[model samples]
Target: MTGPTYRIEVALTAARQLRKLDHPARRRIQAAVELLASDPRPPGAKKLVGGEGEWRVRTGDYRIVYEIHDHVLRVLVLAVGHRRNVYRRSSGVARKART
Candidate 1:
């Protein structure tokens, strides 16, 4: 049987980051984000160290950082960017989410 899907919420900064990407990368990332609704912890998704309940999934050279709220059945997309900078940005985003 199918399970309930989680709601997906993208932070403003992450949305902006996604918009800055090329069409192909943007599409791939978008697809990955959508998949989180049904499977928040898909294969290769990893829990980020030092982050407050944060998780990440890879898509090409980019990464999608998010947090899964099981109680509310929601997935918050904290940041989306190149592997180099995504984690740095996500740490700040995760902090902001707590406030």
Candidate 2:
């Protein structure tokens, strides 16, 4: 069973941004959030800070970024993005943005 999933305050903010979009885009965002909640694991180049770890999900032009730490969770909605840029060196911007 996929116990209760927690959308941390930060992740909630990111998800909120998606909620403001049109139906199709909003559904896309919802899908990505669900994907993250189900298995929020960072991929190959997922950025790493002192925090636990970070990962990215894409929905059209937006980037869904998040970090999973020891006892904390954070997420951000990044503009001017794509999956490629999501996993690039630019992840530092995302790390700082979360803080």
Candidate 3:
């Protein structure tokens, strides 16, 4: 346990709907999520301008969304749809920039 157990919320309503995916896809999503939750702000979890200072990363077909402060992590998953359309939306385009 670290940082008092970070909070994770799917930013888009559609993202919340991912709870029903089959095992394989579900595992990938889970992996990205756990990384954000447990590690030091992952390699791609960069900061976007708005959307509540949220961050994002990619894992194959899915995007890992998150927010990081001094000591806490908040993951706001925007989409689990598809590769192309995932980033087509503004929120997707606004993900934390990569260095």
List the candidates' TM-scores in order. Answer: 0.90, 0.48, 0.59
Root-mean-square deviation of every model? 4.4, 6.3, 3.8
Q: What's the best-to-worst order under TM-score?
A: 1, 3, 2
Which structure is stronger by lDDT: 1 or 3?
1
Off by over 4 Å in 2: 1-12, 42-45, 48-53, 70-99
Q: Write the per-residue lDDT of candidate 2 for residues 55-94, one digit (tens) a residue.
A: 5555667666665443544333332234455435343545
Candidate 3: tens digits of C-alpha lDDT, residues 8-98: 6655654554575677887887777766656636665566554666566777766655556544445555556455554455454454344
Question: Whole-model lDDT, candidate 3?
Answer: 0.59
lDDT tens digits, residues 1-99, model 1? 988899999989899999999999999999999999999999888887667788888898899999899999999998998888886776554332222
Q: What is the lDDT of residue 27 in candidate 3?
A: 85
lDDT of each: 0.86, 0.51, 0.59
TM-score of 2: 0.48
Q: Candidate 3: worst 10 consecutive residues by lDDT? A: 89-98
Give the per-residue Cα lDDT of candidate 2 at 40: 66
